[model samples]
Each structure stands twice: as C-alpha cells, then as structure tokens.
Target: MRRIFILIIGIAVLYSCRNKQTESNNIVKAIAQDTLSKTVAGTADVGDVSPKNDETVKLIQKQLKVLLKNDLKSMTNEDRYFYYEAFDLNNDKKDEYFVGFSNSYFCGSGGCSGYILNHDGSVINSFSVTDFPILVTTDSSEKFYNLLMKSGGLFHLVKMKNGKYPSNPSIEEKWKGEVPKESTKVLDIYEKKLEKYSF
Candidate 1:
C-alpha cells in the first residue's frame, strides 16, 4: 500500500512539473507576439505627421496653377503629380507651404524642383535640384528656420539670406556633420499621397 502511495505521489509531481513548463512556454509566446504587434503598429504610423488642412492645399493648388501655367498647358495629366506639406518656419504662428515636384518635366538627373510659399499662396522661395526628406532645423537664419535638402547624393545646408532661401541647391554648401536631433522632415510623403493637379 505504501509503495502504491509513493507511486501516486511521484506521478502527481511529474504532472505538475509538466504543466508548469507548458505554462512558461505559453507566456513567452504571448509576450513575443505582443512585441511584434507593437513594432508593426509603430512602423505603419510613419510618414507625413502634419495635420491635413484642405484650405492650405487649395491655396497651394491656386498658386501652382499660376506658377506653372505654361508648363501645365504642355504636360499631360499623368505628369502633374506633386507633394506638399505645411510647416511653420518662422515664429510668426503661421505655417508656410513646402511643395515638391516629382514628374520628369520638373525633375532631372540631379533631383527635382521644390518651392516654399507663404500662407497667402505667394512664392517665398524656390529650390532647384532638390531631393525629398527636406529637413528643417531649430537653428534660424534671419528668423527663418534653416533647411537641409539633398541634391546629387549630398545634403546642402540652405539658410535664409536676404529674405530668401537659395534657389540652386547644387551650388550651396554641403552639410558634412551629423543631422541635428531637432530637425524635422517637413516634406516627406508617401507615393500614394502625392497630389494630382486637376488642371
């Protein structure tokens, strides 16, 4: 009888150990799955974090129609793609527009043309041979935020001079140092978000 009791106790102990091991494996798997889900959610949130304001977009379109009047007349609807974002460069509590062209007519081997417009749709600055991920740093030049644009595989530190950013980025000075932590990418957008000009 004692031998049978001993055997029963041994069986119970073995079963308990097996259950504990199974529970531990289940917990590990649950944690791993949770981590993976969070990573995917974070990645999906990346791209053009600024608020979508239809009024600002309309203003940009109005200005673009006049600015590219001649070019628009010659190009097809397929080549009318562009990207834009609104950001405050100065401390005036008003946002300025950043527009970039992606089509062949506006882009070349070096890069594409970008424009900065005021809240009233007036062109404030124009940039040529510019690439995306336009970085705006905390440092200001003449009360306007400094810009970092890529052209020809190099980054240019374009500063506001005499109330205007440089029109030609290829001729500007290159930024050799690391990018500033406070720099904000004001113009980066997904391909699907590119605005198609109705005109």
Candidate 2:
C-alpha cells in the first residue's frame, strides 16, 4: 500500500511538470506569432509615419508599456493608432517614440500631453501636444527641430538637444539646467509662422 502511494505521487508530479512545460511553450509560440505579424500596416492609421522596422516597432511598444502601464499591443487598432508614433525626424541618429495621454480617467476635449523617448531607449522627455493625433513634422532646413501638433490648432516646436533632457527637474540627477541655445524660443508654445493645425 505504501509503495503504491509513492508511485502515484511520482506520476502526479511528472504530470504537473509536463503541464507547466506545455503552458510555457504555448506562451512562447503565441509571442513569436504576434511578432511575426507586425507590419507597417499602421499607415492608414493616424500617425504621420508608420513604424518601418522591427526595432522601431519594438521601441514604440516599450514606450507604450511605460506610458500606459500595459501592453498596448492588445488595444484596438483605432486606440493604438491615435496615440503612438515611431520614426526618426528627431535627428538623434536614433528613432524616437512618442505617445499622447490624458490626465483624466479617459481622454476629454481638453487634450492630453506627449512623451518622447530618448535615443538610448531608457528615458523620455515630456511636453504637451494637447492631444492626438500628435502630428510630427520635420524641418526641411534643420534636423531634430520637429514640430508637434494636436487639434484646436495647438502646436509646439521642440528641438531635441544633442544630449539627454531632464525627465523631471524636481527629481534632480537628470536635470541639465537648460542648455544654452541660439534661439530662446519656449518649446511648447505655438506660433503662426511655424504653421498651425495642418501637418
């Protein structure tokens, strides 16, 4: 009777191990399939530029994870499209990912703000583009001087500094004390000469 009990226990443990292995395999397979399906199909969506490569897509997804605190890959096409952009107009020599978010429980007419991921992929700089669709326009004459725009004619001309920008000055460490620039323009303020509401 004791021998029989030991044999049964061994079988049960083996079965449980197999089940766990199967579950892990299934999860890995699902992730591989999802990645394989990634495409520049977002062109028809709200972004000014579609994510053209896997690196760009993965980086944008990482930024989305930081901002939304969830995997935006599961969101519907319309919702995802309105909030994200992955491209290289920033002239950081690396692509940037931008996302717009609202402070309220849900986005209202008041509009949300923008978060731009830095080149190294570890930090982001914040500015208000008001709301989506956050239109990114590159300057033909100057590189990295991208114009960010939202609805209600809200616009901001943001220049990506050659180095990291502070995420939050209140937090210390990351604060660079505002690098000197030839232009004293306030980044998020809108101007008519820079164009308005139209990308």
Off by more than 4 A, model 1 = 1-49, 190-199
How do the predictions measure up, each by TM-score? 0.72, 0.38
**Highest lDDT among the candidates is held by which one?**
1
lDDT of 1 by residue, 157-194 (tens): 99999999999977889999898765777667544465
Per-prediction RMSD in angstroms? 9.4, 17.5
lDDT of each: 0.79, 0.45
lDDT of 2 by residue, 1-199 (tens): 9999999999999999999999999999986666544323222222312334556546656655666666455555444532344555445666565544433433455555556666555555665425444434324223554444433443343334554433222222221233322221211222312111100
Cand. 1 Cα-lDDT: 0.79
Q: RMSD to the native, candidate 1?
A: 9.4
**Window of ten residues with lowest summed lDDT in model 2:** 190-199
Best by TM-score: 1
